[model samples]
Target: MTDVLRASKFSEWKEDFNWDTCLTGREKYGNFLVSILTSETNGHVINLNGAWGTGKTELLKRLYVSIAKKQHPVIYINAWESDFINDPLSVICAEFLNQLGYLLANSRPKKELVDINEALNKLMGSISKVAYIFKLSSLGYKAVTGDATLNEEFDFSQTLLDLTTQQNSSSMSLENYNKSIISSMLGNQIDLVEGMKEIRIQITSISHILCDIYGCNSPIIILVDELDRCRPDYAIKTLEVIKHFFDVDGCNFLIASDTESLQESIKCIYGQGFDSERYLRRFFNQKIALKKPSLYNYLLKKGIDFDGMCPNMTLTPYSNDNERKIKLLSEMLNNDKFELRDIERFIQKLTACIGYISKFNVKNAKFINFCVLAYGIYEHEKNVNIFKERTNKMSSHGIHCNGYISNGMSVSNFITIHFKMVTLANSSKRYNLDGGWGSCSYQTEMLTVESQDLQTRDWRREDLIECERLIQNYRNAPNSFLLWEDYQKLIGLTDAIE
Candidate 1:
């Protein structure tokens, strides 16, 4: 199965509010929200706002399960998934009826359940008929005015004339007569008004029945998720349908969305100058924003074992300590901001690179570290020249090996020193002039000075010594050294894996 399907299955089994695997500490917040939802007896609408990939959907699913476990009538609706349907009311009403049926299955006597189901079905049938009439009238108007393109030509004018002739025997002009027929067909909106009132009353009765069955005074909780991910018209229509048809005395709505994106969607439908925030204020009683998870904790929860042993240990002669690898990588990434999705993509790419490198048995810690830094820079800047420029800057600055040294060096500084040391050591060569060989060696002098500097800065001595050893090893086996071009090749090879 795909990861999405697997996760969906897992979410079904893991619905309790006190989940052991919730690393972001959201379970406590879920409990708190559930308490507030259950204590309220009147109709309410609460908007849960968070950025994309901030676990809004997961939280909503958990909330659905939590409320269900408490014997409260609750329903979960994914608005984006159902946005393809033209009417949001039908989608919502269908889900509501289905969930209510499931909740009432064994709670009531069979005859009572059948009677309640029959009543609900009858009310829904009436509502559907009224809704269908309104839809036909709307489509008729659109067809007549060329607002909606149809496959065949429509004789709406003639149709109106025929209706007018059939209804009246008095003499009347065709234009005024046609307007009268059209107005009576389309502009007499009281049918929908009366239909909605009936729907609200029926829903209020159903919700009260649910309250008695569930033994709770709270309103039925309806969760609408991913509203911002839907089409502009669908999202707006969902809010309107809920406010008009489902806003009864015993219903509560908790809409989970990225409100900023939802606001933009509203602007798309109602022009750029629309006051979307003020308009949204009419639908929601309060808005709650979810807290974003920390990067380290999120990574850990996503199954990144930073402290575990390095894989393919036999492929390389380096120590099998993965903690150092994680430390260096965390230092490199800690200052940057990444959404949860971006971090997941980064981890996927990193895993692919490590897997490809393992095939070549090139598991040197420094090499892996460079791969991490290169991919990070590429992701952020979208240009390899930034990597080259940093290295070039380090070269021009004379490799300041003795200027300052510390265990807590910034990633930028560490990257410069690390790459420069490798380049200087690997570039050492001998030139033959007039049949005599002369050695041009600056690496030895730089290493000597760096060693002396490390003696004074003993706190980071081990880290600096490890860097010197890597440089020396690369100098001894220059073929194993990875230049910028080699790093690019590695990246290219792994890019297709994801």
Candidate 2:
């Protein structure tokens, strides 16, 4: 078998990977930042929700890199890893402080701030070894005139007085040249150890000093990725933290998550009252849903240039219309001459064949396999639904057995068991087949079909066995509402046997 060429995560693929690759989406993200990163809009949470494997993380990475390249100090963190099912707020705060320290270490501030930093450093060095102290108190007092308040002339003097006289670090204030210099360097800082509201105010104030007011305009963007990978609760809390802490002036935050997965999680955790749909719509200000490009397009963009990998196949423009080609392919797959069962069988065969063909270094073959698998599953589901609608009884799709029948089962029966197994399989590996057929192990049981919606028709005898165990396990338990419902649905099983 010829080896398939792997897609690049960097360099050649970078163009297709970055914000510029999706120009329209980039603009939308920028627009979201402009609307929310304002003085008054400090704690606005925004979610960048999309389906799983839809490149949300890729977008966030590129945006983070772009903002940093443009000279905005940026911090990218994966909340999923950091929070670990704990309160995300504390995690975010820790991350914020970590980034702040990094920024301070890399402070190549503007010329004015540079000068102030040096002067303050010299003055502060004479006083103490503490990390956060400015020693401009005596000099600041001398610089002030009586016409102005004494405190106004001396910045550090006020802080020193507060520390010594009031015996309280909280009483320390910024009032003189020290205040102006410190403010000039780091913006208006009432205090750092305060609550969320104060932190946002500080961020906004520093933003003014760094860009708007100070003329050194650079964008500060924060990218939070892998949110969907987190446990459902962590993911939700991460969203809340973004809303509370980072959505304000001079700072932009972008979050990426799997929308469907997240929605399901939210529904499960918060129940129906949360209005999962509305909540999602509001959170993800700029959601970009990416459908994996068609096989043809994917291959065409991969380029014909072969580096280390062999270019075993190629695509050329066909004289025939594209729609005509697609239609012909569809006809071949959906030929009416074939029996309904044959069509289903053909799909299984085609999926296996296509999967094998995808190993080649050609886009078309790879795409054909992808399309075939996707559409095959889609078509199979449709067929199952149609059958259900017409017959009213959920007939088994394929024939499979729990090996209980001494006489053996037919092919259709075998396939039906397989289909049902796939459809009703739960987290545990165990399942049950109809009748006496069930899993090899009696201890491990599967959730009943009544508990969850089925995705496919092929189920095994293991499915039924698993479901039986699950029903029994939850029997008489205090929190067995869902299981009870499933049990109730299975109470009258006369139809399934027929």
**Local accuracy of candidate 2 as per-residue lDDT tens digits, 230-305:** 8877787777667766666666666766676778788889895677877867655555443333323322233322
Enumerate residue pairs that collide in model 1.
none
| Model 1 regions lying over 4 Å from their true place | 1-18, 109-188, 214-217, 306-337, 362-367, 370-408, 421-459, 493-498
Each candidate structure's TM-score, on Cα atoms with residue i matched to residue i, is 0.69, 0.43
Candidate 1 residues 235-268, lDDT tens each? Answer: 9999999999887778888999989889989999
Candidate 2 Cα misplacement greater than 4 A, ranges:
1-45, 99-103, 114-194, 212-219, 280-296, 304-498
lDDT score of residue 357 within candidate 2: 36
Q: What is the C-alpha lDDT of each candidate?
A: 0.56, 0.41
TM-score of 2: 0.43
